[model samples]
Target: MQVTSHFYAQLTIAIIKGVASCLRLFHVLGLIILCSSLSLPLHAIEQSSNTQIKQVHLHDNQGKSINIGQLHVQADGQFTFELRDEVFSDHFLSMKEMKYIEGPELWCHIAYPYPLNRDFNADKAWLSHDLLFMYKKSNQFGAMMWQGVYYKFTKEDGRLIGYANGVDLSEIASAPEQIHTPFYDESYMEPHNAQERWLPTLTID
Candidate 1:
């Protein structure tokens, strides 16, 4: 039987996912519940007293920090990502193409397939039963998704990893110059290392 490209791609992606699963990636089975607006969903587990949050520095390869944000996770399994300021929002990459497991608590999101890997931060999400996961997607540099949500999240295995929907990238290319500055609004500008990077991926655990 001759198979169509779409089917073939899906099969390949599913296989990759299977391998990833064996390697300890957790898959949440159910329909996705997207947030109404582009904001992190935290109300899902407000009653969980064990929920904890931490503030940390997001950095570039040269060790120069570019963004500031917080990370939130709950005992009920929720992840949220938020940005501290909008000054970083000005250089937002392709956000529509880069939707994540949860909404952005940060200004924008940067992943392997997008512009600055220096875009956003992580937060506990209400999606996947508020499972702890993060993601990045794009049409440029082709589409690439990475996730690590371990349901059996024990202290040894950790709680989250990034993810992808197992699809091909479309209408994506290296961003134009105007959209390619290290994430900054007029007030702040922090440069990265000399190396040119189109493949930007960062994860905060």
Candidate 2:
């Protein structure tokens, strides 16, 4: 009887340990499932945040429409704006010239008679999109590169308005005598006289 009781006691202890091990395994699996479910939403939100704006209808304040060939937005908030109009093609300055023009009063010495033959490279410009504003680095001469220019446009009511350019020139001595707004309404007259005209402004519909 003594031996039988000892055997029964050992069997009970082994059975209790087995049940406890099973419970621990079930608890671990439940934790893994819960963690996996929680991570799915985070992954989805990340993907949504990186969404791109494929196309936006752009118009000017004068009710004129502008043709933007393509706009590619990146995850880091930088975008590329491509012009569809051939008239505006090859009318811009090189990125190297833009660096020198951004400084104070130095750009006025550059002559507009000789136009640069470089193509408008959208990859060179770094465009930033804020809540309702698009800011970009530009060249001072609409048809030439003499100074660095900055442009700020407000996107409201489905129209883009030219808000400001560069620092407030009211206090600067070297500022342009007349603020020559870039992107004016200019028709392409001739290949050599391209600088004599202005193009229409751009707005998003």
Candidate 2 structure quality by residue, lDDT tens digits, 98-193: 212121122211222212222122311122111111112343333232221222445577544432233322223244344333222112211211
Worst 10 residues of 2 by lDDT: 123-132
Off by more than 4 A, model 2: 52-205
The residue ranges of model 1 lying beyond 4 angstroms of the native Cα positions read 1-49, 91-194, 198-205
Model 1: number of backbone collisions? 23
Clashes of each: 23, 14
| TM-score against native, each model | 0.29, 0.30
Report the lDDT tens digits of candidate 1 across residue range 18-61.
89886663233221224333223454445555766644333333
